[model samples]
Target: NVDKAWDPIRIACHVYIALHAEKNEIVVEAETDDDCTTALGRIRVTLFHAEANERTCRARYIVEPPPASYMRKEVIGVEVESAEIAKDRLDRRVKLAGPWLTQKEKEDWEQKRKELMASNEKVFADHLGSAFINLCALNSSMRMRVQFGNIILKRYRTEMAKPGFAFDKFVNMMGQSRTGADFEKMVGGIELGFKLIHKIHQSPDMFCPLDNMTGKLSDIKPKQKLIYRKCGNVSFRLEADIDITVRGGEYQLGENSLYKEDSALKKRLDVEFLAFNSKFDWALEIMTQERLSSNSIAIQATAQDLLSSATVEQDVMDFPYPTLGPKRRLNGKDTANIHTIFQYKLMGTPYVVQILLARGICSDVVGYCGASMYSTNWDDHMGPNEGEICERWKLGSDLRVLFPLPPSTKQSSFATGGQVVDKHEGFRAFLAAVDKVQTFLSEAVSEK
Candidate 1:
């Protein structure tokens, strides 16, 4: 019996951390899954159950509980089904009498049918009654769990208020202060586990855990994701996919800006373009001018919580760099593909990456960006116009990806919180990249 009058000391023993002193001494612990002692495993299961119950909203709060339903299915369905079976059985028995039955036989058959119907009705009623009774029991069992979970948690909190010498050693060994925060953390864990189980839905048949068993929760394994939970609210980061598009206005924009730069230099500085095509003179001129944003937007935090975690800190030391693909064709005389490992700081986070720039001025630049070999034979080459690869920048996420997150942690805050809204930093980085390419070109042009 899950009695309310149970010993507070017994409930306290169920906490796994309190068992250290008795490590050498024989003590009551969670030896079995259902053994409600302060066994760590049982506590985990209890938290799982409490969370599941909260998620499905099966167990109601004692203060203002909702109307209860058992298995949330109708019990009257059983009565209707039982009545049909009884009628079918009676009809089958009556059919055994041939078409040429005597009056006595017919009368006797009717009487027997009547007797059977009366007995069947009683049986059906009993069957329906039993189902309902069990249904109530099931409902009550879950309610008891909710009640007991709260009660035991409260009592557990009290025991941890200032743990006795018995558990002091264990608490200290674990580096726990046994503060109220620690107890609340345990409570939070139960809530988080339940929400996660509900979200993954890996455990499809998650019941009340009224039986305090694993049920379908066994399907889930311990991974980095299971240990994760939401502890904060919605947030937005800046994201700017500000590609350097070739606008019609570029034809008129940059000549004036370039003249302004040269005039400011006090003399007409000599500049020469080597190994350069004339088609991009206009784009280069326009790029010298600053880009502007005339629009403004306001956003608010959302109600949907972060799925895993919002902030994921990564370390370059922990990961090995990606494998580089071999050049499609190579020769002793051919120059190797060179990339600048440009390091820059953004919002105080330093990013060191291999920055390779491709001038989209050449029509064949598309071939390289599209993963096509520059040789006479082309197989995986996309049309030069595809992605406007030749007209604008030959670089974008499809080819030159920026700060791609680790393969894990796709999105979060329901796609609101993690690694999005990066437009401000993004455009700033884009400008930095553009400047890097420009600086390289300027140095080449200035060379005597």
Candidate 2:
């Protein structure tokens, strides 16, 4: 009963065609091979349509053929149901131009993002710059200021790269802080971190010794003793058992001798040195002090040598023996000789004094003349520690010291025909005299 009253279900109308290239439509006549056979016919495409309106459309050609010249393929296409559906589809496929964000949030986000990016970039740049400068200074002997600037840049870069921190964070941190102070602290921290990491990475043996389960010192013998010392601005451990003995004194046990065989003591020393050398400025100061001490010793030795080479002479007139009428002149060759020697000694003294002055030995000269007492002292006094010496020198009282000459040296021919000499030459001579005086004063102080 179901089959007798059955009717075909109507399918939705859609245009369908099989497309192919013309070159693939060429016919080929060949013999059959095994289970396969060949065909000699032109290829064409078949189109399918359920409505008369669809029939007027052009049909595509087929590029290849099988048993028949053409075959029809079924096509299923979707129709837009509503404007909202179409819009949703379009929106998913394409990006819309115009702000989809709210006003206040968008503005705030944009401003914050820009500020963050800028701050981060600046810090990063500074970190890298400082690193470069330090590298130059360490390797190529760059100026301290130049090296310091570079280190600042390097620190900025490093800080910028860290998470939850950007250039802006650094800027804010520095806003209430001094320019170089915060930067210096950051640099110091970074340097310490690097040193700690380097020790861990490069010299693991020192930190991680061979130990048993009891956490006691291992019986294993270390090949070399680690002697830790604070050098310049860095703390370094030397692999040597250096003997420390008091000069011109009896050798006493546990008095002046420092041994590194004791691991605990060595570790303590290492920590102390590291802490001392952590600050760049402090390290430099230590180095400078050592240098000045060494130079002072050398200057003293030179002065002694000069004195030994010179002779002295003295002359004296003696009164007549007790109740004698008048005083008589006596031949005092020894006194004359001593006086002559003293004169030579005085002359030779100036040379050593000059050297001392150059090395910055005399404190009185510094106090009296307000000049640098030593190289280290000069650097410390003029550099960041005391104040902005270079800035002040360039823009303040120091400027007068630099240029003591008048603006013009020439006078009109019509005016009084005075000597038309070089004022610049005279200024140069004046400076030279000042330098000579400084040198003399330095040497005299060193000798003392």
Candidate 3:
């Protein structure tokens, strides 16, 4: 929708091409050759010329009813997670805490049970601390990935009724796993597994579509173009990037605690008011009429005008994307980006979110902390089948802010910046604003 709406020219084209089994909607047994490059292993292909089915002179109805023999209709992306959580860890902790909480009903529970049950937070914290006791993670680190699939999108709540217990409820963390497919499901789609214990519903996944997104993106990319133009490479790229970081990372948290800097710590507590700034920078390229068009990998315009980089990157792939040199490279000379930095507290927090003006179709998480890159050629990708220019694009996807959402900013000049358990208006306002951005993006996707 975004692509066609932006520039119909970049939509799918027709050409002779072969797609792998995964894409062909065909099932095949294959072995992996770790030592080999390019792909896992080559499988035999039973080619059937389109002329054999229904002949056509040029590309006609190429983008629709995908070459029946090529693509399949099977769901492509993530699915809603249904695996039941393994309560063993949680149960064990419960047992240690006393199974009476469960054995006895609300009216029959014992005094200890009542006392312990009085504070699920205290119980969770106690068990969490115990769990960490055996954990060999000191200078160690823990990580979990969240991606768009059959996941749920939700807003944050001010008061968390529970301690985000179920200690090991997340599929990969403490949740149960299936037999064969466990390995490939590295990142758990947002499930009712482990979470902020508060906003357990919001999955930490990032999705980039040709246009705006409503939430889950499992059905967007492939369905958009049932049959793709094989010969003509339809590529996309992004140009802008914004980084989002929450306040309580190992470094800052450690720094604060180590120095006992109450004032410094209070200003950058876990709870925060969300704020970011987005800017766009763009330029134009003018060239010959011949250069304005080509039969090359067309880039689909994204959120056409809402964001310059989105559309510009798409323009680079197809017609009129002008080039100046003897090679007649992309003439569309300018690119733009969006810069967003959330203001945590009156100062800042570790929860950092980066909004980059990316242009193409790519998937990635937030860049690793302190990551750096050095590249040489950056234009080769712009050239045709074979180009002299060598360029590389590195992008990252959603890194959902996993920190517990505290209804609002926890600002203080001194004293312990404990959790905010009273009001939710601040957090609600934050989510509302964030949603407005989504609405704005959706508007961008819809406008062009």
Top-TM-score structure, candidate number: 3
**How far in Å is the alpha carbon of 329 misplaced in model 1?**
47
Query: Who is ahead in TM-score, 1 or 3?
Result: 3
Please provide, for model 2 over 294-327, each residue's C-alpha lDDT reduced to its tens digit, 9 standing for 90 to 100.
Answer: 2233323322222233222111211010111113
Kindly give the stretch of ten consecutive residues in candidate 1 with the minimal lDDT sum. Answer: 142-151
Per-residue lDDT of 194 in model 2: 25
lDDT of 3: 0.21
lDDT of 3 at 441: 31
lDDT, candidate 3, 306-340, per-residue tens: 22221111121121111112232232432222221
lDDT of 1 by residue, 87-123 (tens): 3221210001113335665555556545644553343
Question: 2 or 3: which has the higher TM-score?
Answer: 3
lDDT of 3 at 145: 16
Give candidate 3's error at residue 132 in angstroms: 10
Q: Which stretches of candidate 2 lie over 4 Å from their true place?
A: 1-126, 130-206, 209-296, 299-448
Q: What are the candidates' C-alpha RMSDs?
A: 35.6, 43.1, 25.2
